[model samples]
Target: MKKNMDDVRFWPGNIVVAEAAVAAGCNFFGGYPITPSSEVAAHMALLLPKVGGHFIQMEDEMAAMGTVIGASLAGAKSLTATSGPGFSLKLENLGFGYIVEAPCVVVNVMRGGPSTGLPTQPAQADVMQARWGTHGDHPTIALTPAFHQEIYMETIRAFNLAEQFRMPVILLLDEVLGHLSEGVIPPKPGSFEIINRTKTTASPEDYVPYDTSEGDVPPFAPYFAGYRWHTTGLNHDRTGFPTTDPDTVTFDEKRLMRKVTGNRELIDKVEYFQADDAEIGIFAFGSTARAAMVAVKQARAKGIKAGLMRPLTIWPFPNNQVLAFSKQVKTIIVPEMNLGQIVYEVERSVHSDMPIHRINRVGGVPINPSEILAGIEEAA
Candidate 1:
């Protein structure tokens, strides 16, 4: 198909995320409007129906999350978008999505906050929240991108991972990336990958919704599709019936966790820039990585060996890679828009006692490239 001029134009990161979700076969979007993330909801509201999909602006973030989970259960690829305060509201339903193993996407365009700290400003404070905001011990898969184009691509990848794993996946963006605009050449139709949830092939009477003989992940049959199965937040058996047996509870919890932990090799991803021969390494993610990259270049120009290790997949925390990189660098510097979330991960990953410097900023402004460069130079 020939590309139209309009198709390769610049777009804000949030808008691109919405478009990418649509291209990834998402047919349902249920979310409430929130700063930095509202554009995503608005775009979906306008575009989803045009493509024969469903879009709902719910009364609150909790309802928005519930709607998406229900839609996913009904065989529609669903998504929701929100910021910090709204994200907190969706935690309960997010936990429900986890236990039920519903396949859906949740985009959190992060804003400063413990309680609406800076609604319209950017911050990476929610990094830890994206991993542990929901209750219980379920596994999580989250992807962060640095630029507008990456935001577009990662949104599609988030949906694919959610479907492939039969769980909710998070695309973590901050105000900077969410509202930033840049020219992006949209992927050609059908050129990108799209994954749908696996369907059970067993007879209705024999179907077990949580059956795991296939692997840690069970085949999922859409609700009301001749596969009558029970699903609840309560611990359940392979038949999806509520259970109180210790062994069943233990096995169910492990299954929920292992589907992600056991498959870490397939899900973990990182981007290493100039790290092969660096004396100093900078660790960053999301939009913070953009400035980190620039800082790496500045350090190089100043005759200092510096590089960057940016996590594309934040959860499942990239431990092995961080450990390996730690061995190669004399010191590590972590610069984030928050007062230090991922720095703790880096500290835990380094087996050898290496000096780890934390350069944090939580006042809604991003850590500048100069600040990162200074940290790198000091570490060197």
Candidate 2:
């Protein structure tokens, strides 16, 4: 399986993700082997050393997340991969990454579950968890890619967004897509823009880690880069030191959220299929979107004016785009591997009396094209 970076190959989604991260300049990977996501760590172990980067198999999920955060602070584009239970363990440290503005990516190859429900099976049950897994108020950025090629591109974009937004970005991969193999021609280096964190030019004496004077997102000077600033889990002020003052805390929290929410247009993305003249819209993402796309075509064959709205960015939820798409269709069908997680978001976006239907599946099995087409047919 020897191949160059740009060479086209039939690769599994996890392998493509690892290669894309390498191309995106991910210099550090710290993760533990977890079901449905071990290939990502396995490949990273092989790739990082070739690029003079570091890869560590941590003791557990929490330690793995902490290591990536440390690497990011020390000026490396870092990442970690895991599944549902492991993703849960990473949340506390993930919360730390959020408050300290560590730019790194967390890949959750989702499987069945509230607990360790299914190790090798697929599920979209973690959609809501990815958004609210960490405690307290914070901004979230999560991406869902439906195919092998998309998984490659989106993996790079995940790192880009993490660096651009100065926060931890989540890449949600279901078990089906994580293991799915297909032909992928990864973009050659320098073909696409690769963004790194904005480093501060301020002198060490003048540097403030959380300084918002320039803008909502302050430039971050990496640790050991002749810059000194406090990093903490507690709410902090512009100096990055812990703060208890009501106004300072209020301002700090709002600023954190504003960095992402204020720049929604730049962070949000979606894909549309035959939606321009649709009477029925299918709202789906991740591997489920793959089935939804096929179902859309099948419905059209039956003269059903059906369309699909596949969101690549899931966290910020793409509310405005969903709202606009909802307006054009008389009814919206929400299909997900989980039991109606995203359906609620669809309902919220479409304030009109338009009927919103759902095709929910929680079994380890994927919703096939026929099942989704049947759902669309029923809605039509």
Candidate 3:
């Protein structure tokens, strides 16, 4: 049998992410090899050079993150990939990216662990860490994709959100989804819009890297591009110089946060399946959402009103959508690979006596559809 090669392509999940990043105009990759996510860097190493992009295996995870930030500041669409342990190592630099608003994508193909618990197994435990692993009240944008095709598209969106908001965007993938083989039909070139960071048109003499006069997200001026501005981890004024003044510090902090929070409508993405008039709402994400969707279908067949709300953009958390979904459903079932991370968020979102059940699994395995369906049945 001859298969059509016109629009069909088979790739492992990590390769899809790499190819998608390239398609999104990512020109630089600096990542350390870690299990489940190593394929992303390996494929990036092979693909980037073909497009006149650069790929570097850094000394370690921390350096990998630093290189990505530097490359992004030098006018490159930069990215890095890692798993749980490496993700932890990259947090300090990740926080720096938030403070300086460097545009880059960080891919965390999540495996089990607080500290290298399961290097080769799947887990959705990094959802909270992606949002708050770094210190301070900085902004965060994270996208979680369940399938190979979503991995491809969401990886591109990760780069887009990073460049658009001038901060690091995290692409979170469970180990199962990262290692799975699946077919993807990517859109043709120019089929969709790709975003690049807004560059400053101000002359060299008038460059201000953190200027908020125009909007919350300031135009970026790449280094060595005849533009000079200070970049620091400390709170800084519009000149990008460190400031201790209360007013300037306050203003800088608020703007950094508001860039993402104020644009929640643009950044938040939640997928609802069979949710309308659902009696039992299941909240899940990453690969677990995939299972939950199956559970919803099965429940519907069994004469149960089940729905699934999958948060594609994890941070920013899609609280509004969850709240609205809560109003329509009598109960919400939270299922995830971790012990119980996002369930707390669901409880907070509903903010009522609504019965929210949990179907959590740890120890390096995915939560299956049957388990979720059982949860739905119990809830019903």
Candidate 4:
């Protein structure tokens, strides 16, 4: 497919995200429609088949997640999109993906939550959930984009990282970013790098799906690629067979985490605005980061040395960057649509003596520039 560089389209964030997936060579989409995220599924359903790919609207979120995992294992780059309620249902299978090291992308367009609080509203309440929702010590790579263009770019990055690291990657969007429409320049073919999973070169009898002797990440072969291997949610050994030996279990857990944590330099990313000499830093992510950027500009215009630190990759949290920024600032202010989820990580990274203030808004309303600016002023 050729793209016209001279053409521009005002695309909703969800559509752009699906376009990115298609551009990244995503050949299979297994997802059920849900609010604020259904457009992603709709777009995929329309586009995937046109590109010789497959799309399926599963019976439910759980089935949707399972389908994607199956597709990925069969050598297809697969994806799924969902909202908070659907996201909750995906957690169990998400863990399965982690354990099996299936490369796929799961996009969560966050809405007001905790038992369907607000279906059409936006919230950042899922920050911590994205990190620890699966209930394990496994490493997670989650990217949060603040704008439509970023929604497109990061969706591509999510697939690349998933395939590279051989684990499920989350593209965390919010209701605002998912539903908002904005003009965007789609990337031309061959403009951006696309990564595919590495396949093993060893003979079938010698192949070990979970081997770590070469490195933390084992090269994976497609299920039907003449390689027969066992996979389970239970602890597994180098050959992919289930095991409960204490040594094997501990080794497997460490390798699972090391694939992501040990390579944080390559996977973790952040955007810093006016942060070099600022005394007050505003920490945020996702849609909240967009408003925080505006607030920082306003604060700077008013002679306050306020800057913004927006983490593009939320998990495997950027501890070093946050701590270093903390030392250079007197206070750090974190604003989110949730009631202080990321602030806890900020507090843990910053010096105990440094004041940390959180500006939280819940019940579907977004945190506006005024609220963040006020917090900046109060911190200053």
lDDT of 3 by residue, 167-278 (tens): 9999999889888888888878898679988888899999888877889989888899899878889888888888899998888888889999899988999888988779
Model 2: colliding residue pairs: none
Clash tally, candidates in order: 0, 0, 0, 0
Where is model 3 more than 4 Å wrong at Cα? 1-3
Worst 10 residues of 2 by lDDT: 1-10
TM-scores for all predictions: 0.97, 0.97, 0.98, 0.97
Question: Per-residue lDDT for 219-282 in model 4, tens only?
Answer: 8888887888787898988888889999999988988998887899889899998898899998
lDDT of 2 by residue, 1-380 (tens): 45555677888889989999999999999999999999999999999999999999999999999999999999999999999999999999999999999999999999997889999999999999999989999999999999888898999999999999899999999999999888889888999889998889899999989888888878989888788878899998888889899999999889889988998988899999989899999999999998998999999999999999999999899888988998898889999999889899989988788899989898799999999999888888
- Candidate 1's C-alpha runs over 4 A off are 1-7
Cα RMSD for candidates in order: 1.9, 2.2, 1.6, 2.2
Instruction: Give the whole-model CA lDDT for all candidates, comma-separated.
Output: 0.91, 0.92, 0.91, 0.90
Evaluated with lDDT, which candidate comes out highest? Answer: 2
**Over 4 Å off, model 4:** 1-6
The C-alpha local distance difference test score for the whole of candidate 2 amounts to 0.92
